[model samples]
Target: MVRGKTQMRRIENATSRQVTFSKRRNGLLKKAFELSVLCDAQVALIVFSPRGKLYKFASSSMQETIQRYRNHRKDVHNTLREQHLQQLKQEAIELMKKIELLEASKRKLLGEDLGSCTCEELQQIQQQLEQSLKRIRERKIQVFKEQIDQLKEKEKSLAAENEMLCEIREKIGQQARQESNEDREMVALTESSENSDVETELFIGPPEGRIKRTLTSLYI
Candidate 1:
């Protein structure tokens, strides 16, 4: 008959549990000793019973083994810490490089840091600046044209005003000349009337000469 597999668990009975603890402790110590002797390996084992009894085994001095374990752990910890610090330092270096690149890019955008630029970069910047200058010049020319148009309009208005003023002056001069000619013609007519009165007086004899002739006739 084939036997069934035993299920491993804690023994409920106190005496049986103590017996099992004793047997397992001795067996575990024996296995540890054998493993150390056969393989020339260092071993340490420790156990605590339910009654607070200590059971321990070590291939070497227990204190020495514990110290060695602690030292090994310390070394592992130091190694991991050093690796972490090195990774952090590498990350910091990369971050610094990124920051420097950003700063350089910012300076370039602001029209600074040109001395270190490559030929292609310089050419690109020059092209952009030239395009901006062309746009600015075009705008300036447009503004100048608008201003010139305004000035031309103003000049046309001023020319019209000057022509109107010239016409007004010509009309005023013509009126003045007409008035002067009328005054001259009136003076000439007055002078001709005065001369005709003088001629009529001379054509008729003097009243004194007629009186003297009548007195002489009465005397005769």
Candidate 2:
């Protein structure tokens, strides 16, 4: 039984070592499975023989569970590191804010905010203001480029739409022209019919003199 004291050293005999490894491996696997089944726990077990053969088991994927374990352990170790880094970032931001506030206070004391700053503070403010201005200029350049791109795309779309509109307008104009010509032809034919009827009436019954007068009237 394991209750008996044994020397705290590696087993020297190859056979005994092998036997011990086998027994312990079986016990470890049984315990792993029992924990998974009874407690609904995710479990993974791995062992390598002296000959370097892989032995692995898991409640789910052996590889995935081992990887998860390693990642979880790493995250745990880095928690304090993440906190420290976050604190440093906060401190930096606070320090910058304080520097800005201090500069502003000094400016106000010198009546700069009210339009009278010492030459030294003015120089410092100018340098910082120049840096800020440069950053804004860079941002504006990027925005301007984006706006130009958008304008180019918009112009292309408008060009295409305008082309379509021009084609539609031309078609409408052509149709109107066709309709006008048809109306003119109809008017000409109607006038010709009236003149022919008048001539036939004159030839059938009217006197020659009256016919000439009618012709003159018709011409008028």
Candidate 3:
């Protein structure tokens, strides 16, 4: 039967755990020494037991190795920082060049800096200007048309208002004329009533009575 793989876990027996710790610690220190001698490499190791016993190894001065590691990390960090700074400076240079190009193009569009332009470039500029002017003219015409349409709508509204006002005025005139006619009819009726209230004496006695009355009226 094939042997099963040993399960790697902590040893619960205190004696067995201590024995394992001693053997592993010594083996690790021996391997570190061999690696340092064979490869001419710096090596440092430190281990602590459960009872706070220290186990340590170093192929060179431990302090010097630790200091050299820290210095190497710092130098690497500075190199990366310098590279990032150079990248930023290069980007800034590229952006400045782009801005200059844009400014030059703007100047050309505005008809400035034409001394370096060839005939073909001049013709291209002229075409661009003409296209721009055409668009401007079209926009202007559209605006004018919109204004005219608005004015027309306003005029229609005013006309409708005027028509409504005229209708109101006509009704008012009709009312005034009807009132005047009614007043005239009332006046005529009053005058006819006053005329009917006058009395004339009969003619038989009227002639003599009328003559006496008339003479009496004249004397009074």
Candidate 4:
């Protein structure tokens, strides 16, 4: 029968744990030695027991392996650091370019640096300003027309009022002339009636003095 796989766990008993540590340590060292001899490869191993006992195996001098490992780690660290620095430098250059573009845009918005603008850009700005001027002129003309219309209306109203006043004055003058003519006619009629009302007497005869003398002589 095939054996079932072993489940690994920490040993609960101190004695069992120590025994297992010794066996595993020896086995690991043997495997390191065999790998070096058979494969002609450099190998190193280190182990520390629970009690702080040290064990190690090396195909070469232990100090040499440690020094090589340290050197390799240092080389890797320097390579990574150089790569990071180069990446940062590239990003900084891109950021500076972006900043320069932003500053140029700001200058253009503020109406500065027009000398450096291309023909197309200048044309665009010119068209915009011209459109604004046209709008302003149209608005001014509209306002002037409105004012002129109002003035014309006022002039017409004043003319009508003047005509009405002139007609009223002429009517009053005609009525006064008619009243004066009637008064003069009445005064002439009264004076003719007064002349006609005076009294008068009339008689017809010869000389009375000669007739009286002849009659008196005869009688004497």
- lDDT against the true structure, each candidate: 0.92, 0.89, 0.93, 0.88
lDDT for 69 (candidate 1): 96
**What are the root-mean-square deviations of the candidates from the true structure over C-alphas?**
24.1, 15.9, 9.9, 25.8
- After superposition, the stretches of candidate 1 with alpha carbons farther than 4 Å from their true spots are 1-20, 118-220
What is candidate 2's local distance difference test score? 0.89
**Candidate ordering by lDDT (highest first):** 3, 1, 2, 4
Give the alpha carbon lDDT tens digit for every residue of 89-132 in model 3.
99999999999999988899998999999999999989999999
- Score candidate 3 by lDDT: 0.93
Which regions of candidate 4 fall more than 4 Å away from where they truly are?
A: 116-220
Highest lDDT against the true fold, candidate: 3
Q: Look at candidate 3 and tell me the lDDT of residue 183.
A: 100
Model 2 lDDT tens row, 1-220:
4788878799999999999989988999999999999999999888899989888888998788988989999998799789999999999999999999999877765546946567886677777778979999999999999999999999999999999999999999999999999999999999999999898865455588777888999999
Worst 10 residues of 1 by lDDT: 201-210
TM-score of 2: 0.38
Q: Clash pairs of candidate 2?
A: none
**215, model 4: CA deviation in Å?**
99
